[model samples]
Target: MSPRSGLQREVLSLYRRALRMVRTKPPSTRAKFLLFVRYSFHRNATTISPRQVSVIEHLMRQGRKQIEMYEDPSVKDCWVSKEMKEWNERT
Candidate 1:
């Protein structure tokens, strides 16, 4: 197994973070959200060009923003999920 490149690490990190956030969503919607996240990543995996660094960076920024918004308590509900919010409050 070869060492992973920086870009590969970034993509994996984003995917993991997105999934973690998805866990905070209501149970009924979690599956749909997971499917959408997986589909979006797979759809772009083939078309991404190594030469286009700006495009990759832009997508990363967008993904980060989307995650931030999704995790924000004010955006989705009056409070973040109890389990996760308690974890956040501790650290």
Candidate 2:
């Protein structure tokens, strides 16, 4: 698919995720708001790859549940740094 179409799909998927949060029993309006803000902010940035998008989305979802999903040391290596490009190559 073209880059534009790919990006549109990502944005829509994020939107759906945000919408789904609204149906939670206790009603996490605040959490949904935060999710929407973070999702929109990340979606606007053009420098990140689709792989990075998946990683960030997972982090957001699980982190919202208070899960320590980033405990594995290797996850930090995926974050941007001087070595990030080389790190991506190694993976």
Candidate 3:
């Protein structure tokens, strides 16, 4: 496979930053935050074609904004359900 493009690298960097940000949350709620990040990023990945550069860029901008919002200390816990947990594990 060819090397990843700049936009692909940026998307991956954003995802890595989000995963790293999960460590800042309280230990008790860390799992919830983790599941949230995983779900949010993976949700639309299959639906969005790689050729859709405009859509990908727009979604990346949105993802960056969301990561910034959740990176704040105020975001201690995220609401996650049993089904969501199951899905997270399955994926």
Candidate 4:
């Protein structure tokens, strides 16, 4: 919920931890995953270009809506691309 106040690496570490927690849970999985997704999209929202945070937020609010979209491996890769690279480079 709070903006990342730490260094970039620390911020990314926190983000990954948050995502892992979300993915491992049951009831909180959706909410936490949505939070992670929203945070990712909005990380540079203030300083960077416009993104679909509103849509992501909306989807997060509505549980399991468009849930089938995750079945596509491409989206999953997009999400993990940065993690896989271990850099701050865009996914």
Give candidates' CA RMSD values in order. 10.7, 12.5, 1.6, 10.7
Candidate 1 per-residue lDDT, tens place, 1-91, comes to 9998898799899999988987888776675566656666765776898668889889999989988887875443323344444444564
What is the C-alpha lDDT profile of model 2 across 1-91, one tens digit per residue? Answer: 5556664565566555544443332342344334433444454455556567676666456544432222232322212333433433554
What's the CA error at residue 59 for candidate 2, in Å?
Answer: 12
Model 4 TM-score on a 0 to 1 scale: 0.32
Give all TM-scores, in the order shown: 0.74, 0.29, 0.88, 0.32
- For each candidate in the order shown, give its overall lDDT on alpha carbons: 0.73, 0.45, 0.88, 0.44
Segments of candidate 2 deviating more than 4 angstroms: 1-4, 28-91
Using lDDT as the measure, which candidate wins? 3
Question: Which regions of candidate 1 fall more than 4 Å away from where they truly are?
Answer: 74-91
- Shift in Å, residue 44, candidate 4: 7.0
List the candidate numbers ranked by lDDT, top first. 3, 1, 2, 4
Residues 3-69 of candidate 3 have per-residue lDDT tens digits of 9999989989999999899999999998888898888777768789989999999999899888899
List candidate 4 segments past 4 Å from native: 1-6, 27-32, 40-91
Model 2: residue 11 alpha-carbon error in angstroms: 1.2
Residue-wise C-alpha lDDT for candidate 4, range 1-91, written one tens digit per residue: 7764334344355445445545644552355455545555455444443255555445343423333344333343224343533433343
- The lDDT of model 1 is 0.73
- lDDT value, residue 55 of candidate 1: 90
Clashes of 4: 0
